[model samples]
Target: MHMADALISPAVAGTMYVCSAAAAGYSIKKVRMDTDTKKIPVMGIMGAFVFAAQMINFTIPGTGSSGHLCGGMLLSALLGPCAGFLTMIGVLLIQCLLFADGGLLALGCNVWNMAFYGCFIGALLIWRPMMKHSMTKKRIIISSILGCVLTLQLGAFSVSLETLASGITELPFLAFVATMQPIHLAIGLVEGCITAAVLVFVYEARPELLYAGEQANTRQNVFSFKKTLAILAITAAAIGGILSLFASSHPDGLEWSIEQLTGATELSASGGIYRMADTIQQATSILPDYAFSNSDSVFGTTFSGIFGGIVVIVLCVLVCRLFKFFSRKKSS
Candidate 1:
């Protein structure tokens, strides 16, 4: 869930921001300095794929609520933990700035809550241990669902805890967590299935990708055509544009959770110091809460998803290409 700038306090947000930045920096270093650079293209394309997949949040059957793929552990399992972490950072950046999926000030917290645990912990703790006994379809599916559920559940709880710790909301700490976690549990199941599906596809068609990752020192370059990556990015952008049209007029997962618990959904954003910044952004953002009033629907959602996908893919590619180039230069 994209925590709005309104929901978080500067202290809590700033703390998480620092933590997220540190973790992201560490992840990049782990991947860049330690791992082979040939895998960069895979990381970039997969980052875009995650962006696109997130855009297509499928409505949970019979619930009238929706959830999207988070793609963290899946990326890690496929790409290794370090690359997955950096890829997630790239994805979150696209979502926050270009898509306005999450606010600029709140980006760090969002990244930490959503990406850090999933990429690092999910991969290192859950997936790796489980994969030792079995890489079977059943095992991968079960592990993915479990890992994703735990990750989202943890992140959602962190959001509740962070906001409560900040003393930003009148909501009680346990109360906020209670409100957030269950819905995300449901969301996590969806993520689990989607991740398993993608992983299964890759595993079946190209087990070499995962097998190669075991030899982390010698990941082969798979940069030819790879049209799937480009197609996925385009598809994700299109889904974002299309979904902006039908985004439940009702509050989303987090907002809905708050509403169900409190009997009211709207929280006042007036008290925080970030208010001025929020105001300036509100003024500039044509669709602050993702709605366009004056302009025709065409202007809505704009191309941010597509634009974001492009930015993420390009940045990832550049980072990867640089890693590859330099690695080659050193070896030569």
Candidate 2:
């Protein structure tokens, strides 16, 4: 869930930003030690895929709430935790700066909530133990479900806790958490299924692409790495270009939860930090809310999806290359 600036105070925002930045720094160190540079393109492609997938919020049955794929588990499964975490940062950054989908001030909270758990806990704790030794479709499905549900549960709780810590909002901790957990539980189930499907496809096509496949690629796969990347690239383009048009119009899980609490999907908070962040976001966001500034034409959403995906891909690739550059320099 993307937190708005209104939900956080400057102190809380700054705290999370430092925490997230530290995590990113640690991940970069780990990635430099990870000799498998072959995963760089996969990181970029999966980042784009996750970015595009997030644009289409699937409706949760019986609840007015909707949710999209968080992609932490998916990316971590393919790229390992360090690379996956870095890739997710790219996705969130692009959404924050370019698409205005998340608040600039709350960017740190969003990254911590959405990316940290999925990449670290989901990958290291759940996916590794479940499927590391024996990679199978059933294991993939189970790990996907468990990872998404557990991490999302933690992420939702973190949101409530962050808000409570911020003290800007009057939402009761117990009630806010009570509402957030269950709705996100539903969202996680759907995302898990989607994630399982994608991972299964990748496993069958090129087992080397999976985290466990580092050693599990003993058997030959039909599709080459290039072929698999090509397929994923095409799928990402199609989803962002075409499938995004059918996204649910309902507010997402976070918005729906706030609406349930206060009967409004958003709360307004005014302060120097908030206004400055908003001003920077407004200036940088060429496509705000995935639409043209003045028009609601379907093309704006389409353009945003494609353009955002490309930007994320480029950003992730650049970050990966930067990490590699430093790694080589250190060796030389």
Candidate 3:
């Protein structure tokens, strides 16, 4: 759930920005320390895939809310936590700066709430533990479901806590939490199933990719990394260019929660910080709401999805390359 500027205070936002930055720095260190550079390109492509997947929000039955894949666990399952976190940063940044999907002021909070728990907690605590002794289709399915569900629950709780800490009197803590948790539970279940399917496919294609770092030395290469990347790239293009057109029109879990509480999807925020953040977002958002400024055609939506996915891919690749360069320099 992407938090808007209205739901966060300047103090809370600033604090979260610092916390998320530190987390990113730590992840960068971890990634750089790992010698497997092959994951860099895979991370970039997975980031693009996640960017595209998030565009297609499926409706949650009986809830009047829609939810999309967060892709944190999926990335971690393939790339490990450090790279997964970095990849999510790319996805969130592109969505924030280019599409204005989430508020600029709230970007830090969104990154922490959505990415950190899934990347670290889901991957480390649930997925790895479940797959410790061995890997199987059953283990993958169970871990994916449980990991996704745990992450979403934690993410939802984090959002509620952040909002409450920000002193948003209109949204009482208990009520806001109650609404966010149940809705996201439904969302998590759907995401878990989708994640299991993707992981299963990848496992069949190249099992080594799932636990790359741990099994890199022992596992034989059954498929080329380039081939897997090609398949995923095609999948991303198809999802972003075609399936995004059919996304459910209902509000997402966050928006639905706000609407339930206030009868409106957006709240008014008039502080100087809020105004400044809003102005900057408006200025930078080239494809606001994932469509051209004056156009709402299918072409515009399709173009936005593909273009956004490309942007994420490029940004992630560049970031990974930069990290690699510095890592090499440090070793030298």
Candidate with the greatest lDDT versus the true structure:
2
Worst 10 residues of 2 by lDDT: 323-332
Q: Which residue runs of candidate 2 sit more than 4 Å off their true CA positions? A: 325-332
Please give the clash total of every predicted structure, in order. 1, 0, 0
Q: Write the per-residue lDDT of candidate 3 for residues 36-75, one digit (tens) a residue.
A: 6778778878898999999999999998999999988999
Index of the highest-TM-score prediction: 2
Arrange candidates, best TM-score first: 2, 3, 1
How much lDDT does each candidate structure score? 0.70, 0.91, 0.88
Q: How do the predictions measure up, each by TM-score?
A: 0.83, 0.97, 0.95
Worst 10 residues of 3 by lDDT: 212-221
158-269: candidate 1 lDDT, tens digit per residue: 8887777777667777777776787788889888988888777666545545523343323333432355445544555665566545544445567777776667765666
Which should have the higher lDDT, number 1 or number 3? 3
lDDT-based ranking: 2, 3, 1
Poorest stretch of ten by lDDT in candidate 1: 211-220
